[model samples]
Target: MAGVILPRFYGCYNCRKRVALHDDIVNKDFVAGYRKRAYLFSHVMNVEAGNKTDRRLLSGVHMVADVHCGDCGVVLGWRYEKVYQEAQKYKESKTVLAKYKIVKLDYW
Candidate 1:
């Protein structure tokens, strides 16, 4: 976290939806398929929208939903709603963008 960091972009699961900028990534380890990585950006270009679900996960208690590519409907990661677990409650307002579901775009 030092000098002149350039920006990097990432796309959605199926479509070329620019979902994340380099700095928007919350995890230190920017490894693909990183566990429960969240981002502030969603599909940049046109990809469909307003598709969300309120569902639970793990023990089928905490409410979670897959944040998919609206155009292609590929599962991104998840959005936490109501978490039953004590640790997961903090993620209630965050969206986890699946690393494997996105492709890193080259810097222009």
Candidate 2:
């Protein structure tokens, strides 16, 4: 027999609903040198403008595994490419995408 550990909840900012965390696709070695780090970068749109909304744009996709709260479905930190690139100019640094907030649904 095999046992699996999974997240219990996922909060969606768009709909403001807390959904179950299923359909997980884990990439163990998404980032190099950062053994525990993973990347989840998907295109998303900014729909806050009502009509004439901007199209989906490229979001940087790099995250550390330690910042996620499986029980509450919150992400403490994340790193995006734009921020990463900027940080790279100075040195190798990871940008803090979000700090202790519900992981936005569109972020995936």
Candidate 3:
């Protein structure tokens, strides 16, 4: 019998809720707060965005919202709501998840 292959996913660290697919990762060299590693995903699931606020980041000022795990309410990262700099406009509407805050799942 042929074994079935499953797609890999990234889950919340607090709870094993599936959040983002490994295939959906857009940028893997992203850096989160405090110089921590992160990844920018094209899409995400099982997460809730908090209130939008303007903050100065390494890039520049951006309007972002903190994203939390829908199940355990843990802060995973932030979603880019708006980008002021024209060169950084590509980040808008994308989600950034801290590498330490997520775990790889479905790997055989």
Candidate 4:
């Protein structure tokens, strides 16, 4: 197993449940709230989404749902359920996990 390599992933900060792989990251220059740093991921696992609600964000009004850790039920970030702006439509169905809410699970 010396030469074998494991995929790097991010886990819930509270429960350490695997949530997303590092390779799945779509954007790293994202902000959660005012100045809180966050990352956008194309996919995630071991997380539950809350009810979708239309909220006005920095970019524009978007339908989003809060995503929580499945094991600990802690709010990590929000997922874009619907993007109203045509320019932001690429964010649809994507999940954003707060940088402060996830921890690296594997060695670099």
Q: Residue-wise lDDT of candidate 1 within 48-74, one digit each (tens)? A: 333355554443565655566766777
Candidates' TM-scores? 0.58, 0.21, 0.92, 0.93
lDDT of 3: 0.94
Off by over 4 Å in 4: 1-4
Model 2 Cα lDDT, one tens digit per residue, 1-108: 359544444343334344323233222234323333433323112111111212222334322232233344444333332233453332112322221233334422
- Cα lDDT of all candidates, in order? 0.57, 0.31, 0.94, 0.94
lDDT of 2: 0.31
Per-residue accuracy of model 3 over 31-106 as CA lDDT, tens digit each: 9989899999989999999999998988889999999999999999999999999999989999999999999986
Candidate 1, pairs of clashing residues: 55-64
Using lDDT as the measure, name the better of candidate 2 and candidate 3: 3
Report RMSD (Å) for each prediction in the order shown.
5.3, 12.0, 1.9, 1.9
lDDT of 4 by residue, 4-101 (tens): 86889999999899999998999998998879999999999999999999998889899999999999999999999999899999999999999999
RMSD of 4: 1.9
